[model samples]
Target: MDVSKPPFGDDDAHLRETTVSSQTVYQGHFLQLKRDEIALPDGGRAAREYVIHPGAVMIVAVLPDGRLVMERQYRYPVRQTMIEFPAGKLDAGEGGLACAQRELHEETGYRARRWARAGVMHPVIGYATEVIEIWFADELTLEQRHLDEGEFLDVFAASQDQLEAWMQAGQLTDAKTIVGMMWLQRWRAGHCQFDWQTVD
Candidate 1:
């Protein structure tokens, strides 16, 4: 053990896992499964398997009436419908903000005039490199929605109080949406700030 170097230190001396080799075990339409041989910090080697994602974006779309646009969609893997913010995976070469705009309009039929980046998160850091960019959208206008073929979801609006209550009652369990709600609470309470921008 290196006493001078801590695991969370600035340098990589204490926590270095070098990838000796990598192989793609499976490749799907939007995800790739990879297995890698890594040299551990100690004198040992290990095999790690994970998924590769194209990244994604989540929108906390707020209406002028102090309500949020939310969605209820069935998640196949979980075999249940979940309440979540409008979100979608980024297309190849698409910017984060562009993806957010596209998903919001496609899912909720609303376009936002004002946009702000809230933050980024890794929902599956342990097994996947899926990064989701969080965005706040406001000053919205009604627009025609174009959901992807074979997609079905119910879009609705909810107040902050209602959302908080749902969360407390375990009705809201989506990780990204929970994070977005926390950001919203912080922003509303003056505990956090956002860099607002105008969408063209």
Candidate 2:
């Protein structure tokens, strides 16, 4: 399938909403909330509130032994420790590949010789303007981690079978990690192809 084009052409016009007015409700160091008045397709007016984010990248790094690099960290919003792929927000003016590489190294201390962009996913389309760009990394070499200040996490490795079992047991619930696992499985099954590149 050609991913460059939208699945439906002009048929989606009826579902489109035009922004009448927009206001910033709140602004933080990383996220901005916006409230907008939109003109509905049915000639009605409505308000929409959503977050404006800088976007992020999630890395699915594989060790030489086939174990996937993972992390366990406390998420304040959910009040629970979560298992997730190495991920981080994009710094100003950073490209997707650059963000992926930096995030993997900073969070897990693993740099990859070969990398491929799997796909992008919108985890919260209902409220947030955030999208996670997924990248698959292999040929990893361990280095020193440079975690951000106040960031606390435990970096570990797990196999695909273990991840699948965790998901079945409701132990792995991070959406991006789950999606990354699906991409890995699909690639392994030869359902898709990745144009992998080597980087220094």
Candidate 3:
């Protein structure tokens, strides 16, 4: 490995693309499709199509006994039930942390006394501008869940070991959930650090 070069190399020299024009192909309740003409580094022009997302947040809620709060919900796009952390899209003008807090309560009926932002990940980088902020919640309190009218899910708890086993067995396949699990495992082992915050 050549340590002198940055891991992804210099963005300006090797990774920059200039957008020439953009067009919105479709706009839906939650997503907007866009097509753009861009000038590539090699002086070639190309068209790219992608989705414009409003961003979202995912929470890894930890109970006092070290179990994680999780959810099983049916995803329409994939036509399969998914195991995921409590998450929701950012409402119009909503902040990421606020969305995380609201999602945890609305989806799992649990509120945390302590919160920490783990990190962020772009689940669909190739064609979508969706960024999900990962958060960790602890010191939880049970509360009434207020799910959306047509929303349905089963909220449950699982130990870290159980989650690890599930992941190994290919049972947990949601991208954000897998990223959350990785972050939790690393943080627990002191390989990663989180800036914890008091509940607002």
Candidate 4:
């Protein structure tokens, strides 16, 4: 259905908000909080606050047996251990595919010989300007993992059926991982296709 293309049409002029003024409220290592005064479509002024994040990449790595490589880690903000696809934020000036490759190898010790970019997702559209680029990887070879300092996660493999079961049983709650599963299912069902690239 070509969901990436949005029909902005003439309604955009009526719904768009123009930035009047913007200022940084807080700046972290890679995240920045900004508050902006915006001009509403109805000629009203309002303030909008949001977080600016360095975009990230999520990898849906698959084994030869079709099991998906996954991770379990504790998220401090949510105070819960979450299962997710291997993902990481982009370093300054880093490309999406590079980040995906690095993250998959670092976290899961798997280097993919074939890769395909699926699409991008905005996980937190309301309060954060964070976009995650999704990639699918196969022909994986296990290697030594080099997790970043203080980063801790357990890497495991699960079949698509297991993932679906978890989702239905309220266990798989990671939005990005769920989206990856959807893409995987659609691709497997021939509803969509990926332009696979062989990586050295």
Over the stretch 1-200, how does candidate 1's per-residue lDDT look in tens digits? 89746777577766879899999999999999999999999969999999999999999999999999999999999999999999999999999999999999999999999999988999999899999999999999988899999999999999999999999999999999999998999999998889999986
**Backbone clashes under 3 angstroms, per model:** 0, 0, 0, 0
In candidate 1, position 107 carries an lDDT of 90
TM-score of candidate 2 to 2 decimals: 0.96
Residue-wise C-alpha lDDT for candidate 2, range 82-157, written one tens digit per residue? 9999999999999999999999999988999999999999999999999899999999999999999999999999
Q: Rate the local accuracy (lDDT) of all candidates.
A: 0.95, 0.95, 0.93, 0.94
Q: After superposition, how far is residue 138 of candidate 1 from its true place, in Å?
A: 0.2
Model 2 poorest ten-residue lDDT run: 4-13
* Model 3 alpha-carbon drift over 4 Å, by segment: 1-11
Which model, 3 or 4, shows the larger TM-score? 4
- Residue 178's lDDT in candidate 2: 92
Error of 3 at 47 (Å): 1.1
Each candidate structure's TM-score, on Cα atoms with residue i matched to residue i, is 0.94, 0.96, 0.94, 0.96
- The alpha-carbon RMSD values of the candidates against the true structure, listed in the order shown, are 4.0, 1.7, 2.3, 1.7
Q: CA shift at 1, candidate 2, in angstroms?
A: 9.6
Candidate order by decreasing TM-score: 2, 4, 1, 3
lDDT score for residue 188 of model 4: 93
In the range 124-158, model 3's lDDT, one tens digit per residue, is 99999999999999999999999999999999999
lDDT of 4 by residue, 78-189 (tens): 8999989899999999999999999999999999999999999999998999999999999999999999999999999999999999999999899999999999999999
How displaced is residue 134 in candidate 3, in Å?
A: 0.5
Stretches of model 4 off by over 4 angstroms after superposition: 1-11
